[model samples]
Target: MFNDEPGDNETFLYKLERESEVQKLIAHLKRSKKTYVRRRAATMLGNIAEISDPNERRQAVKALVSAIKTDEDDSVRAAAIDALYQRGEDAFDYLVAEIAEMGGSEATERTATTLLTEWLSADHLEFRMVAATALGERGATAAVPDLVRALTDPAPRVRTRAAQACGRLSDPRVVPPLSERLSDGRQQVREAAANALGAIGTDRALAELVPVTQADEEGLRLIAVDELGQFGSVKPVVVLVDALDDDSTTVQRAAMLSLLELLTTASTEELELICGTVVDELARADIQATVPALLDIAADGTRRRYRQTAIWLLSRITGDRYRSEVIDCLLPAIDKPDEETAQLAEAVLPELRSPELEKRLRVYLSRERGSEEARSRAQAVLDEICDGSSGELVTTGVDYTYVDSPADYTNQHSSRD
Candidate 1:
């Protein structure tokens, strides 16, 4: 028997005396046969928990906790959790403990995830953060929408937790919202978004992270590059290649390492195709800046075909800018146990023919410290340059038409199938 007066805005504690009204609500919450009645009782107890009377607040909390533990209806249990949540810190602690305890059962786990999803909108920041964390830990895919919305919470910590939760869920649906967070004013939120985009590891998700690779923040760029390594896609690999020229040497190193990590996963054919696309798209100056990374790949690359592609890219892109360094990388490969690497180096060397390259090869040949195989390779490449037959060979299989400008190249390629 509860009061049903219309337009009565007085607090529940004052409208109905503490002992009588509270006892009735608790009885209905625990023993009511009707589901709606129990739901309403649970809600009232939550409102009552906000009252200043300590004894009444504890009684309300105890009733809600009982409803959570014993209520047969999911809605009733959810209502009880929401009610207990309003009881402040002590009840919130009890609520968390009860959810953890209930988590052992599949049905209760669903109920807990649903309730936590609703808590994402709670006025209290702690509730939002804890709910996000719990949903992520539970791997609640159903909570993704709420988590995405929470990505824009006024509090940076809430946004960070929500981004992390979205990542843990690994749902593609969160990709766009996470992308928006990449530019969040807060660095931690941006980093979390980048990390989440990487964790999702979908093409769309990985694509969202590309812009972040150019972020002004070095740490953010480092995170973007590192996460891109987890995915073995052409886009991320190409992005990593470009990152090789980053102003920050630390980023440059990370880009190189991520490129190597990608090699371990991406197929040889994929790397070769991406390498060709990279060569076609990158401006001459940008290509030149990548020499160090390309050399690193040429030296420590895992697959023979990829290493050869790296060498080919080095030849095509370097032109004459970093010829000395390119020669240094190639000469060592020529002496390695892998014959394909040796042959690729030897083939691409003649294409790199220049007075400078010729002089380097001659100097290399004169040095007794060089490996015999390396010296022999150098001799052959040097003879090609001197005999005036160096530039005749098309070592790189891709046909090249020189464009006056990068814009011309882009327009030509864009028009092609």
Candidate 2:
């Protein structure tokens, strides 16, 4: 058996199949004079609540709950509460009753909230953070006001937990105060605040989140960008697009994912408008840097339209020099069963024309694995670029219309549909 020294709940509870261990620990809880021994005993009892016999588990829980209310040692009391936390909903009522008893009232409407409030005000920061978390786990709306108040606690740890509790409570009234914390002096608190607002999910929450996307701190900006992306509104598209250039690779990758989410249901006109931002970036020679991120989207076959649209957008951004890179990724996609992917690749292939691309197309045409229509479309693009005799590449099975640049995409900016 692993030594039950101090906080080793893992080892003490690891092999509890033997009833002797349970009897010994339960006896320790009853008779041990040392607070640390009794605390670990309480922790082990809670940990075994799942594996112990039904009668034994119930007895252990009852003992732990009693200890939580009466233990003189603060660590013992905290450990009992944490162990009960492991038991989940089974322990909620006992904890609530303990709160009522602690507050000296079962009749008060705010007994749970009141108990937690006192805990949050405790002089010790660790206790304050624990109380903030317990209030969140309780998931009571009445606790929102208290948690919001705790958001500005002098200790950053308390503020961070308070912000998290606000997210779990998901009360709209908490949005205003949580929004203020987006600019909190501490980065962890700011990130937590942004996440809390995202959970609240009110229109106002999204509006408040937009500004944090521009925050100087990369951690806050990353959270704000991720939360803003969930709204899928074009309003934050420009901000998300700007995040594509954030110096942190993590932030840049996050921005690309958000952009993909925004584009998933966007219309042709919306695509034009969103991709139009990339066009402006292209003007500044900034678009080429995103080639790797865009290729990630193109290669992710699970996101079919996203992959197709990414391939199309990449063809526009990369030009002939990246012709081989674009073709290498898209060529395999042409034979995919999803017709949208095949069609999109066929459309993009015309734009990526070069003698090297021509040779690859010829190879694909000769292969028996591709759909005949795909082969025919490949032949058409080959003819347009290789033969230099084209008004436009037309195939019966797929449209190989050359994707024009800004004009084709930008001209539709006025039409939302």
Candidate with the greatest TM-score versus the true structure: 2
RMSD of 2: 11.1
The ten-residue window of minimal lDDT in model 1 covers: 1-10
- How does model 1 score by TM-score? 0.55
Off by over 4 Å in 1: 1-105, 111-124, 225-246, 252-273, 286-288, 296-310, 337-347, 353-417
For residues 206-298, write the lDDT of model 2, one tens digit per residue: 889888877888887888777776664467777777777788888887877777666665567677676666445544546555777888878
Error of 1 at 161 (Å): 1.4
Considering every candidate listed, which one attains the maximal lDDT? 1
Write one digit per residue (lDDT tens) for candidate 1, span 1-417.
233332333344344434447777777778867776777777777675346667877777887877766777666776777676565667856665555454667887888787788778877665676688677777889888889889999989789989988998998889989999988999999999998888888878988878889999998999888878767756776677778788998898777666656655677768766555556644434654577777876777665655776687778878566787887788667777787778788888877776666656655665543578778887888778778454333343444444436996797788895
Scored by lDDT, model 2 comes in at: 0.72
Among residues 3 or more apart in sequence or in different chains, the pairs in candidate 1 whose N, CA or C atoms overlap within 3 Å are none
